[model samples]
Target: MENEVLQDVMLTATILIPILAALVEVLKKAVKLPKNLLPLISVVLGLILGVVSYKFTDLDLVLRLWAGAFAGLAGTGLFEALKTRIGTTK
Candidate 1:
């Protein structure tokens, strides 16, 4: 049961990463934030999304928060990697 729960958190994080990344992109375009602040924004956004999504999953608040943190970091990394690969950096 413990392992399954962890797996669920991992899955939730994985799913949220892309969505968070896209949201960051939208913010990037709509707002004039410094690039250095994007990751921080992503994390906060992820936490908000996770907490608000309680109705969608049975995970406890702590687990959901952990998943959100992971998703936020991963989302930043994924976005950076894709941006670099596509020659869109800076």
Candidate 2:
């Protein structure tokens, strides 16, 4: 359980940093992107993160990678749905 949590932490960090960085760059450069793209972006970012983390960290590569992908999709779906249902747009 602890090990899974640790791996998840590493996975989240790996995925979030680059996504946030890219978002920053997009905003800074005024890059135009399609709407409703955030979810797909998250997935791709998750994949990249999974690969890198598995390469550099002491985690089960296949399991961690799958976990990252699952977490990314489920997380985005859950949060987005919650936000919409709660009528919070911020």
Candidate 3:
């Protein structure tokens, strides 16, 4: 079961990573935000995108995959948010 979970996690992560990266790039170009801010924005966008996906899926393996993907994406975003806050602490 652990292997299944991890496999799901990795599968989800792999798929979302590319989509997130591409979306981030498009947003960067579209909004003209600072290049340095891409990571932060990507993190936020990724979570929001994930949430939206989570709310709108109801298949079998596809649903599971989407759930896992969004979980990973949001977790990654949360990690980045924490990392940013930690790095900026005075």
Candidate 4:
């Protein structure tokens, strides 16, 4: 039960970290990031989030990679949604 809960938390972190990173990137204009680099940034952040969240776990390598990819996709989707809703005209 405890292990399941821990895994859930790790998975949530795996998804949320990249999304949060994307949000920060979009909201902050001090750093001039090229728009084309957003996906790369999302993937990298997802990879880092996956590794940090699951490093101590005994999960398979493929599973970890899949989680990271999912995180990247989630971040991209969230970023686009927020951008459309918030109107990034600034």
Which predicted model would earn the best TM-score? 1
- TM-score, structure 2 vs. true: 0.46
CA shift of 42, model 1, Å: 0.6
Query: How does candidate 4 fare on TM-score?
Result: 0.58
Clashing pairs in 3: none
Question: Which candidate model has the greater lDDT, 2 or 4?
Answer: 4
- Kindly provide the TM-score of model 3 when superposed on the true structure, using C-alpha atoms: 0.53
In model 2, residue pairs whose N, Cα or C atoms come closer than 3 Å (at least 3 residues apart or on different chains), thus clashing, are none
Candidate 4 residue 28 Cα shift, in angstroms, is: 5.7
Could you give candidate 1's per-residue lDDT for residues 33-68 as a string of tens digits? 999999999999999878876887899998899889
Tens digit per residue, CA lDDT, model 4, 1-90: 768755854676565655656554764465778777777777776766666656555655555655665677677767676665455464
lDDT of 2 by residue, 1-90 (tens): 988777665666555554544543364357565647766765665556666666656667765666556555654565555444355445
Between candidates 1 and 3, the lDDT winner: 1
Q: Rate the local accuracy (lDDT) of all candidates.
A: 0.90, 0.58, 0.57, 0.64
What TM-score, over all chains together, does every model reach? 0.89, 0.46, 0.53, 0.58
By lDDT, the better pick of 2 and 3 is 2
Worst 10 residues of 1 by lDDT: 81-90
Scored by lDDT, the top model is 1
Q: How accurate is candidate 3 locally (lDDT)?
A: 0.57
RMSD per candidate (Å) reads 2.2, 5.8, 7.4, 5.3
Better of 1 and 2 by TM-score: 1
